[model samples]
Target: MIYNLTYNGIIKVSREHLSNKLEVGFNTISTAFKYMEQSKLFILSRNRSGKTNCGYRVILDMQHVNFESILSEVYHLKAYEIAIVKDEFKQPNKYQDLAQNAYISTLNGSNSTLNYNNQI
Candidate 1:
């Protein structure tokens, strides 16, 4: 949903809007937004007066994400399996950069770590 919104150049959003679109409660959307912000996937800012919407800048740069580690840690996938899946991609370099950035982001302390390796 966020990716779609970002793709459409819609950065500003409200909890109510998301709630209605996702068919979820407002607080659930708020929590999800907060989690995304903490994950560095979104930059959230408070709106000015008379506005209920919040400014959300979705971070779509693949270089900043670590798909390998995320899949391994979060989804319990093996490195070899990840390698196989990555090989299926037409442009595997993109995934390689994402793996590298995971190491970079961890060293830079920009992302939460879950047993990330020191070597890239």
Candidate 2:
């Protein structure tokens, strides 16, 4: 239920709302959520509006250290690194001359004045 609800972009969900769909009492759902938290399977937050009013939001934790989690972290890191490298090396076909000139200028000297002027 949580997976289905969160598969879209809804990060926050209530315990009562979950319980109603599952056809269980609020306490039972709350207890199961508490167990999941204690086992480090997921993270849970209080409703903050007391027991009668609000629903708890569930957040999936990234520190589980499982193979799937490790793979996910590695995949994300590699993707971002590739994107950064791509952005750093990007040059328009029409502006290739300008890009090459800039690259050559940087390679020609470590000009502190030019670097400072560019930053300013």
Candidate 3:
């Protein structure tokens, strides 16, 4: 969902909708969003004004060329290279020699979990 949302250059997200889609609790989604925001992967517009969210802007993925033009036109967002982050988060190789395991680089931020955006 995150990948698709970012790739599509759509930034708005709702805890309720994400909760339903991911079959998780609203609080769980909220917590995840909080973590992402803290990690700088997303910029959240937090609201304590009763169960309503103001949505968020996902950290733009510059390596994903498909979204650049769309994002510029839609949100006037110019995505800058995140400096070695995008390449480090790509999916694992589909075909690797069984004898040699390629290390899949993990996404590291100030305080974040292992990023598996490739799968999401």
Candidate 4:
């Protein structure tokens, strides 16, 4: 269902929505999403400064990582003719938060403006 509903690699799927659609528990949908994320089959949207909705991007075309080409070829989009989707983490982000959070202790009690010079 998600594959059929997806548009331009972007899909707005929620745990509850999937649960209702698939006739399964919400937790089941959540676990399935987690497994897909770990396997790099989906990219869940991270909370941004102003984004208020919960959504995700589905990577249906595993053979192509360059999403711009999908727009050009499938959607017939021109480079200068439109605005692009503002995807923060365009690729798989399964362990991105884990790695960043693991090093947060080093940033505490220090001026964040100063450079650590790739120490983390």
lDDT of 3 by residue, 33-118 (tens): 66554454433443344456444434443334554465456555545543233444453433333314433453564554433333
User: Which lDDT tens digits does candidate 2 get at residues 1-120?
Assistant: 555424532245677677878899989977886765554434455545665675467455423334234334533446566456345434334533443444223544664322222221
Which scores higher on lDDT, 3 or 4? 4
Q: Which stretches of candidate 4 lie over 4 Å from their true place?
A: 5-7, 46-66, 69-120
Enumerate residue pairs that collide in model 3.
none
Instruction: Name the regions of candidate 1 deviating beyond 4 angstroms.
Output: 5-10, 50-120
Error of 1 at 65 (Å): 14
Q: For model 1, give the 10-residue run with minimal summed lDDT.
A: 55-64
Choose 2 or 3, whichever is better by lDDT.
3
For residues 8-118, write the lDDT of model 4, one tens digit per residue.
464445666678878999778777767666655444544323566555433343323455666476557687532443243255566655544543333566644433233
Model 2: lDDT of residue 53:
70
What C-alpha lDDT does candidate 4 achieve relative to the native structure?
0.52
- Candidate 2: clashing pairs of residues: none
Residue 68, candidate 4: alpha-carbon lDDT: 62
Better-scoring candidate (TM-score), 1 or 3:
3
